[model samples]
Target: MSITRRTFALGLTALGLSACTNQVLRTAPRGAKPVAELPADLRPTPNPGYTDWVQGFKSRAAAQGITETTLTAAFRNAGYLPGVVDRDRNQVEFKRSLEDYLAIAASDERISKGRAAFARHRTTLNRLESTYGVEAEIICAIWGLESLYGERRGNVPVISATSTLAYDGRRGALFEKQLLAALQILQSGDITADRLTGSWAGAMGHTQFIPTSYQAFAVDYTGDGRRDIWSEDPTDALASTAAYLQKNGWTRGVTWGAEAGPGAPAGRIIQPQEGGPEFSVTRNFNVIKRYNNSDAYAIGVGHLSDRITGGGPLRGSFPPDAYGLTKDDRITLQQRLAAQGFDPGGADGVIGSKTRAAISDYQARNGLPVTGEPSRDLLRRLG
Candidate 1:
């Protein structure tokens, strides 16, 4: 969700860690080769089984009313990009501390831009909120995160990437469906082949709507026949995201959450694991999880939403037992815990049940509060 290194490792592990077991696990290895510096065109190609899938995709597109010209042009020079697969597979290593993630994601630049955009489009956002029951700042934040307010919607062709992934056979069924959806969009003339570029996963536009999301939620806020999320106008994209959250049960009049102070009374702490960081999340927080099913992601959005609405940071520090941890600190704790045989079950860094259990075990052995938290004292003992 937030794309932390620890989360990537856990994702890889979820994909069956055996495939990646031979690779090194360190976040930063000494003398490692830089992947970005690798020569282009030296990567591997599809296994030849993908052509049939591509043909099927084209046929499905045609059935959906995509013009032959659009389909042909979109797929003409499209080929499997090994780099996309590599990125999709290799996973990230550096975990963004919560503060760091928020600082960048909701930075002055983003906030300044967001506020300007919000002010400029006050009428539109207001209408959208009234109609969709989703807040303006949340929409602005999504816009900021997805494409930096539409400055970088990616250059990779959506059809090509989806086709490649569909043909690759790893997640064929899923990608094939997405490929068809992309073609449907093309067929509808909502966007052209050249303008239909997006992330490797086929998520497009200012708010990174995958084909299905685009088809399901995209709007013609500009009164144009087509839903143009790729345009400089963010009205359609923001509206679409709002529609999505509203559809998914976003509650009106409720804030995501507030920064808890050190003296704040403990709310209903939902510990993912026995010794993980305690969170007092609300029902709306669960709604954010539906958007991206990760605790950190939900928390990030919640925290960012609060900041955009002029709220302060968390007042109380996280329970630290080992790793001198904060919210972000849990990611590294998870990784190190895994290395130490704790197996926190996919190091996405939100201290779930297994992580707490591991922390408790570590604390019991080391003579500390078996609170299973990663407090400063625990970090000192761990050190």
Candidate 2:
């Protein structure tokens, strides 16, 4: 996902990179944003179990070399965050087809923002590419997908979110490890606890690195002696991402892959969705999977990177869906719905809740069955 996949290898909501969210620009196509402010549910709440768990964890953290002073400061305001638990417990309910994934992952907003961000940060990105031997657009694509050009780096307190998830007893051991790594970051003085914010599941900064991943790979590209991915400047985060791909074995100058065609690169052919366009992926493609192990994610990053470099969208088209509707049909239905005074929310062809509501409202008024699903018959009727 790119839905709340904060570090899915920890098997959290999403981030090797795990899940995604609705906003996608915040991102996973899977795009999950940490809003302008934390919601009430995300704030701290009393939980005796969590308090007790923290005591034990503190002792264990000490055994693992965390200082008593660090623990004291780290936990001064840290506590259980129920919203973190809610987010951890809930995940993307359904699988998204490649087409739907692209619709969100490579949406117009993301593409446009990606190009502008590339130009805005061209110097830093180009410098990182030279240092790490990764493509600038690749780095920019990850930035777009991870935090939407630094606009949606989360605001949740890492200590509270990780500690709460750790004590929630679901992925306790794993998050406890993240909590421990976060403490180490704090101890290293890269950032203060007050400023250590990220997604609820612990993915931090512009690139959404989980604490452990941050520990293993983060870099201080600005040479300011700190990897400050959490700030408005994205130098360190982008370099760290480039470093990750290079260290993980990105073949220099090799194309990730592309929709198979006369111009396609030589590599293994994979079709992620049935009757969809075929892709030929290279070793570098697998390198991207190291960030978030989904074929869809890898494609989203790759395609979005190409688009940012001024390439076109995929020329191939996916077949009709189970609803016996092609994307064009859906667009037509939405246009027709809006024309009839029903709002289908501007015809992106996804047929979300608004489209369903419009369809149902129209159905009820016409004395038809209340099922809001689209069909060829529905399209004809809308006409």
Candidate 3:
């Protein structure tokens, strides 16, 4: 799955805040410390109800067959992360245009890197594809998108993040289940407690599999005892991602979809937005959706994979965005919005929730239609 702004933000925030713990663990290696005896510096600031929640969850986890040692190691210094709650409660608006998404997912630089990475790992990817019946480029596309070819695997402690979300009580059952899965991963000895780090939401490894996803689909591709997705080697993660897609119905030798011109073969067609490049997708496209459950994301992966494998860009021209702005114009709009103190997250030419909210507030104050779409008129007015 491609890392969206929300996931990227979650990763960045988690890593940024974990500086203390990372440093401490670097100097003083953690042993089998009891939850209470763990150093305060190792934990986030606990809320009033957090301790009780942990104790209750401890009992439940014990009942679920997680050993006492596993529970203690997993929760040694865990506490509620306020940032996780903020991210969960207010997910970034998922209004990025396909163009915006591709600008990051399949940028020229990214395509170059993807090609290099594909070439570098061709032998291993070939074997995996032959074994799994999933395409190598697709796996490479996911690798590029999820962690930029292993450039940005997150650094947050998975147990802490999931346990915090579990105790936070908003999505208690889901996070509790995830926390249990994390403990299981620890018990299995793939990765240790200190090294079991990932996104703020607990998506781990190269392709960002959550704890449950890892348990269900992770593979030991290298004949090693561990399905070590965190190591420098990307074989297991890529193989695991392929296994997942295969399990979910990736048709062998079938493409996800393709760009179509006028009078193209009729299938399940999706344009993403009005007057954009159209795709004649297949069941394989839906299979890609199981990875991220977003049309734009699936297309980005498919198209980028195609590009990585030497395919050209779409021939059909995308009409103006809903706001009557071209892709370049949208980039300008994002820059202008940020310049005016309305941060649309990053100036990546995407009109996500933050951008829409900022635009709405601007419109409400200035007597314009509250349409969240960016327009030439809005850009000029901001100017």
Candidate 4:
């Protein structure tokens, strides 16, 4: 009943959805046109095998009650996305330390934007909370983590993505089921073929529900007779998320948890990153995990929810990283690299791919070995 991720890249990625192992990370934005609007690699490419696979799947789909008209319309525009295959094959579950994760997850920009989003949608969020017995901030936090408040809701067509993965055969069985469910969504007419876009893994909308999970938990708070999670309004998306948590045993009116400290309530004590802050989690926290079953993601959602509610950053300090560098040192390194136009992305203190690339570039430019690894000497050199 949930969609999850393997991507910190798609960032829809990471904590991938229910049975789909693909991450929900970054991808094309909403309303990208086929061929014309999409990047060349993402456009449908010629694949005889994929064509044959679709021929077989169409028979199965027809057996499953998908009308011939719906099949034609859905596949008329949908084609095998080579990029989705590339993303599926190349996804690596890199472990970002909680400190680094928080730097990106609850950064000033995300928190500020989250608070703004909270204000803008307070009425609807509160109404959903009342209706579903889930906290508004928790719902907002999931919204922030899932698609950056809908700004990055992916535009890859669901039919193509699911069908491609289904044909890829690595995870064919799961994708086949998802493919069926996606067809059902089309058949039901919640969204048209052209508009039924989602992440490369077929995770859709503000909260990134894959087709099966969408069928299981999506709600139409608008009551307009359609559960439209893809719309810019986000009412249905937020409501669907709230409904998910409520159904999954979210304890009404309880905090997901707090840093284990004074007045911290009794619950599970988990320190996902050793030497990082310890959290005393409540049932609500586990309910959050039912959305994305990762301690780090659950913490990201919880902590980001806290920050969105005007809470301060975590009071605990993490031990130095394996590189023997503190987060501050890493941040300083990234800032200096970015200042010189090496561009390590945001100075989030996460030595991610971009940061490593910047490090390698700086090293090469300065006649140093291009190890791309950071060291105190490198930090000092950056100085």
**Each prediction's TM-score against the native?**
0.67, 0.89, 0.79, 0.94
Model 4: lDDT equals: 0.82
lDDT of each: 0.62, 0.82, 0.74, 0.82
* Residue 139 displacement (Å), model 3: 0.4
Better of 1 and 4 by TM-score: 4
Q: What is the C-alpha RMSD of each candidate to the true structure, in Å?
A: 10.1, 3.8, 7.5, 3.1
lDDT per residue as tens, model 3, 1-383? 43332243332232211121111011222222343443443347758687788898889889999999988888775676776677566643435556666666677767999999999999999998999999999999988777777776766678878887888777777788888988999999898897787766787877778888888899999988999888788999999999999998998988887887664445698888676678898888888777766787788888889999998877877667667777677778878877877767556565666677777878887888888767787889988
Greater lDDT among 1 and 2 belongs to: 2
| Model 1: lDDT of residue 190 | 88
The C-alpha local distance difference test score for the whole of candidate 1 amounts to 0.62
- Comparing 1 with 3 on TM-score, the higher-scoring candidate is 3
Given candidate 1, what's the lDDT at residue 43? 24
Tens digit of per-residue lDDT, candidate 1, span 352-376: 4566788898878767678866665
Ranking by lDDT: 4, 2, 3, 1
Most TM-score-accurate candidate: 4
Clash statistics: count for each candidate = 18, 33, 1, 19
Off by over 4 Å in 3: 1-43, 262-266, 331-383
Minimum summed lDDT over a 10-residue window in model 1 is located at 23-32
The segments of candidate 1 whose C-alpha lies over 4 angstroms from its true place after superposition are 1-49, 60-67, 92-104, 107-109, 260-279, 319-383
